[model samples]
Target chain A: MATIKEVAELAGVTPTTVSNVLRDRGRVGTATRERVLNAVAAKGYRPNLNARALVERRAPTLALMLGCITNPFYPEFTLQTNNAARRHGRFLLVCNTDYEPDGGSGFLAEVAGSLSDGVLVANTGSLQVDELKSIQATGTPVVISVWEFPDVDPGIPCVAFDSHKAGYIATDHLLDLGHSRIGALVGSEKNGIHGGRYKGFCDALRARKVKHLKTDARFGTDSYQGGFDAALDLLTSTPDLTAIFVSNDLPALGALNAAASLGFNVPEDLSIVGITNIELTSQSRPALTTVAIPTAEMAEKSVDLLIKLASNDPDAPAMVRTADPVLIKRASTAAPKSRATK
Target chain B: MATIKEVAELAGVTPTTVSNVLRDRGRVGTATRERVLNAVAAKGYRPNLNARALVERRAPTLALMLGCITNPFYPEFTLQTNNAARRHGRFLLVCNTDYEPDGGSGFLAEVAGSLSDGVLVANTGSLQVDELKSIQATGTPVVISVWEFPDVDPGIPCVAFDSHKAGYIATDHLLDLGHSRIGALVGSEKNGIHGGRYKGFCDALRARKVKHLKTDARFGTDSYQGGFDAALDLLTSTPDLTAIFVSNDLPALGALNAAASLGFNVPEDLSIVGITNIELTSQSRPALTTVAIPTAEMAEKSVDLLIKLASNDPDAPAMVRTADPVLIKRASTAAPKSRATK
Candidate 1:
């Protein structure tokens, strides 16, 4: 067994240089790097990485959990968050929760002891409180995005979109377009954020003195297919409805397809407003009207939150950061056509 | 210092139970688990993760490097590969190169000495050879997906699609549809696989005795916006071409949008064929006719290869596994109609 000093002496470098090269910290010239590596091998220098890691109290990584990677909106979110993580000199461990109860739990169990310093649940309504607690008990900090635990206080930080405000804006836009009859495409109860969005939708209608129809609100998974099915269900059950406000953009695209299939022209026969404003919204046949949740800004803010959680006072009061949502007027919304002659 | 035997004695469990709890291995009874944890904490037992990791000769993690995470094609790839990795009890560390030279180098440098057991470069045309070599020298196995070093062999394993065959198939599809004037959209040269695909494009035209007009082929980055600009350039410069074959789906999508903005109806006015039938292809305004590279199959195969490289044989000969591509006929392509009389 040899010491760091011995390896450095043999490699013709200072102990600090050898340590830095071993840690891969500072810039070491290629030649110097090779010499240090060779000397480390020759000297059988095996540093206790676990001991070092315990002392450092960080893993230079962050865990990001999303609903599903294939959902176009998530790809944008992932790229931005990953870029932000890299800029902060950290790597991102992305987990696809598939919005399943088991998906989040199984992944948490898998990474129990070996997790990075902090976790960022980038998607809303994916993780249950118990699942999050399992992760939190491991001593890794958790910062949730978009959705918060409604019933249980998980005692963690959060970055959220003003979902209720977005919902009101979307509904109000349709209302201004002379659409008195509106339908809601809401996700399941599992998604905590949808509660606020749905509430806002109802509140907007109440404010306008419009009666709320239970049949107008359809709940399902957060997917394009889900949105498509919800739209079909709503259109068939509530024939008088002239507008629909979808919770997210992926399903909103599905609703657009549904409208096309149902022999109705978007904006002319039916108006659609969605949230998230993903890239495809602009390129869709009718071009979707959406509420833009600035994913890049959210990712940046969430990364900043994770850094603070990892480095600052561990007992600091949990902070909730809110990102404003903007309404992007596109080709999809308009006043419904006058009723056909009876 | 507390030994495993001492901790187990106080917890009323076997020493193996204490060790398993410390290693975060196979499940133990809840009561036993709690007792073991409490005893370890009370007795101040600290197992060395470095010693365990060294003895295991691997970490239960994989490094997956992609050109960009925002590309819709990669989200599908990442999800499938990540699922496969999870099933095998390994997690993935995702790295986004962003098609920049420094991005890959900085990441490789950052993760030095603390790398996962295996690496998967999931995108092509992004990183240079030196960047890959720097990662390879870390003593962890490297497996490049859909890209390889052209000038310098990085002496690593690879999984690639037959891009040449895919190019020929896409071009041949257009030729069989009675189109003589066809244009091509080639991605950047930095993507190692593009060269083969481009060569195949030329060879197909040559086989058909179509004149190899230098103006017919165009190169650009493999992105929707990149494809958009390239299509705009080609459509503006070449007025008589009936169809275009794009090397990737992202750019092909751009081509679709560009054609729409230029007032050309897809399939009816300008038949377009793309590669990598991404999830959005089927849902696009005109369903895209694409060369479907079985990304899921590729991911599964690559994961298996990585497992082997990480375990069974560190010294095994570097192997290249090729996945075949298929042509998916969709609404975006059709026979060119004879010109309407002015």
Candidate 2:
């Protein structure tokens, strides 16, 4: 906790000279710089970042507002953003909006442009565009880190990935495996947050001229239990289906387990695929076949853009489109038994 | 981005009066306070928390240094701590040390006493006690949020849960089911971070007069793949074991899948028990029967203790012991087939 004054006093130099030596700025004699360095090392002088932030008119951290921390995907996104921020010599201030009563409006009001230089909103589905814009109006840069739909701009700065492509890849993989009877498990309403992915599923089926009946799809909450119950109900009602396409990974893992519980040998009796190849997809029993969304790329790009916007860089894009989702074929999908028998 | 001076000028008051009215301090007439408030709302002035922190010499955030954010346990722990910090009107600055080249020594040196008011170290195993003490010596409060061993103090302010009891409860659950032929899977070295839990398992076995063979145990990394590989090996070698006690939930989950892969029906062929009932344990098929550690209680206590220490409260205890670990009986355990037939 040695102050700059103490170090300056010990080094027999002015406080500004000590600051110059520490920040590697301004001209100081080599001997004077050495003296300041020795004094800093001897006294264990660490510069106060908050004090420096005030002097520079820049906060030392970026605030990342996430809806739910325990949702599995957010942790991965947060970790990537945290590392990306650190690489830029900044710390990440994580604001979990799920715990906030007003869903983080209070937090945004308090910290925007004051305690934090920029804000990154991860769960854009739960946040309003006007709220983010209002914070942006206060001159704190706000970037939507995970906009699921790239085709429709959210009217705020965002990093978007092709959710429709992710769904298409997952469904097309099952179709390529020669499965005509495929069920869809949407993690939200038909036109909710996961609408793009659901649309892709329908498009992929239509492209192949496969008839997707009304009873072939079930919509529910976007969670493990949601996937489990929906899959259980779907499979029980439509027992002849050869494959299932789930909108999200959490529920897909649930479908995987639910398939096991119902004595349906995965990829043999029934094929299953999910979008967003989260870490759990690979670790599951059958090693889920999922379409890998560019989670890390989107996270890093979002942080980079937020930092640029905060610095008033003219080159910062309003919407950054990341790499397309790719198919990650694993043990969960295979050719239908009818084809195998032929 | 409106300044306090602008609000003061519009309200027809001195800057000091405006400040006092805004902070609700000093004597001010009701009419004057109303004028100041109206002007503040009209001007959209938000206080710069960094400047206020500088004036008060108190940072507005607490730093939580965790090893891995993606780990199921850490997210749960981080969420609880985030919620607790929010309740105190302080933001949570999460530092993921696993990505740090110096393993967070540099992050600690930079933010400990400057940017964050206090540091809460969640992953205590990899961090050195001397490093934590050094930060504490610099006038920043450092609290170990998840000290596994309560009997042995880590020489820093900490919140500890009974890791030993957590192990005991998990092992005792298996013993109660008449599974004498039990194997052990330690997620760390036999005498490493999970030693307390491993010891509890041994004690539980000894209490029941059940002999535990050295060959019936395996030690490995505390991850899903680690548990999967180790359990696959353990079950292959010690096929007679009717039950297994895993030191941690993540590894236990791996073991559950490993057993399933090996064609063993959980609770029927092999009753498995794990410590720390993470969210995944309940979501897994048939669910995992594990000991539930007081994760939230420990997190809240740690944040409270750190806040108290930051305020230099004399009543702050050196070490706080949280509520004992309890057994959460799920679907993962049952009586051995031998005992059931008898």
Candidate 3:
């Protein structure tokens, strides 16, 4: 509970001298520095972090605003961001918005009020541009991850994967396997990625001359349970469908389970593909053939960009780095059976 | 970047008066308060958070320390903890330790030097007691989650699940199903939960008069690959074993897949049970029968306890709260076939 003034008084030096010694900045005589250090130790002094942040004009911390921690995808992102933050000698404060609108707004407010040097905002599909702008208005540099707002001012940087391309690749793969009737197990349309991926799917089908591509699109929760429910509904509604493209790995896993329980053999009677090749997908039975986004790379690059912005270098170009998604073909995808080929 | 003095001058008040208004403490005339608020709005003055934290003598944020975010279990815990923290008007800063000997000590130093009110530490499996003590000495109240240091001072509160009981329940259930030649697929011995669970399994076998209890334990990474390797080793060492109890769900799933690939039928030829009943367990090929911990409840209660301690309540008792593990009997466990049953 010792104050900087108290430490200064004990060291027989001005507060500025004590501050400089603590920060390892501005020169202080060796003897004076030793006296300050001894006084600090003697008084059990803890540096006043808030006062230090004000003097340095930097919080030396970053905020990572995630959509939901439970979403498996985020842990990888968190690890990468933390590692990158450490490389720059900065700390990260994580906030989970839980995909709730109110929670997202409240979190934005709290983080904007905190002394965070920058923010890496990973939208959970629901972002209000105005809300984001207000936070940026506080002079905290922000790097948007996963989801991007098209209308965001050029000043805001974004690091994302090409969800539309991912969707196109997944669907095109199924089409190449000679399956004409494919179903889409898309997530909630409220999600920006979901919408983009769905649009991509539609575009691929249209370009392939596959008329009346029976769409079994349904909106459900963004979870395995939601995927299970959606799969069941899709199968019941479009029993002739031979292949399915899910929005994410979790739901794709759920679809696989649903197929098994319904007595359909994976890759023989039905084919499934998912996005975000999470670790579980590789470990899953009949390993998922999905698009693997470079989660670590995205996090690392986002942090690097945020740090550059925080350094107050106006010449740093505003960037939108998009890593291409790699299609990992595993045991889950195979040629459609002859009976369903036409 | 208007300073507090500038805002005060605009509001025609002393800097101290403006600070009090910002803190929402001390009596101020209603008209003066409105004037200060209007000045803050007009000048777009954002209070320096570090200065505010210093003045308040408490940072309105909590730190969450975990082993690794890549582990699905930690994210689930984080989700619940974040929700609970939000309900109590607090923010969380999550840090990963990667289960090293340093055990998040480096992260703790950064947090201790930041605007954090308290810390919730978990999964410091390899860290010695003294290392944790050093963190506590920094004057931040810490609530150890998921792991318990029995030798440490009892005054340090901990929220832990009874791993031994969970082990006993899982192994005992397999025993009651008439499986005698049970093999244990435990985690690294360095992990307290792994050791505790192994001990409990051993005790259960002794009580049941079960012989040839193959303890094919392995020390490796705490991950699915580790479990898969352990399972392969266990199968090679004890080909006659009828059932297995894994320390965690991820590894249990890995073991299940390994058994399947080895052409062993689940529950018919071998039964598998795991702890932490994670989401993947239920979604696995054959839903895993495992022990379920009340993660959200534990997080909520721990935060409640920390809030009380932070309020400077001398009467608050240091306590250990345990949540009972429930046996979620699923399709993964059953009586071994007559040929395998002893």
Give the residue spans of candidate 2 off by over 4 A: A8-38, B8-38
lDDT of 2 by residue, B123-191 (tens): 865579998999999989999999999999889999998888888888888888889999999988888
iRMSD for every model: 4.6, 1.1, 2.4
For every model in order, the TM-score on chain A comes to 0.81, 0.94, 0.82
Alpha-carbon error at B311 in model 2, in Å? 1.3
DockQ for all candidate structures vs. native: 0.34, 0.76, 0.58
Which pairs in model 3 have colliding backbones? A50-B50
Mark the regions of model 1 whose C-alpha exceeds 4 Å error after superposition: A1-51, A99-101, A124-126, A148-154, A189-193, A236-240, A312-315, A338-342, B1-51, B99-101, B124-126, B148-154, B189-192, B312-317, B339-342
| Candidate 2 to truth, TM | 0.95
TM-score of chain B of each: 0.82, 0.95, 0.84
Query: Which runs in model 3 stand beyond 4 Å of their true positions?
Result: A1-47, A99-101, A148-155, A190-192, A212-214, A219-221, A339-342, B1-47, B99-103, B148-155, B212-216, B219-221, B339-342
In model 1, pairs of residues that clash are: B125-B190, B125-B191
Query: Could you give candidate 2's per-residue lDDT for residues A114-223 as a string of tens digits?
Result: 88999999986556888889999888899999998887878888999999988888988998889999999998899988989999999999999998998989987489
Q: Candidate 3 lDDT, tens digit per residue, B251-332? A: 9999999898888889888899999878778889899999887777778877877777677668655665666788999999
lDDT of 2 at B132: 92
Model 1 C-alpha RMSD to native: 5.4
Local distance difference test scores for all models: 0.76, 0.90, 0.78
lDDT of 1 by residue, B1-342 (tens): 457788999999998889888667888988889999999878756553334555676655688888787778788999989888887867788888873457575565444345467778786344666666655665666777654223334466766567778888888898888888888888866244577777777789889998757797787657788888999899989968889989888889889889988989988889899887888888776779998877887788788887877675765446554567788999988888774322
Better of 1 and 2 by DockQ: 2
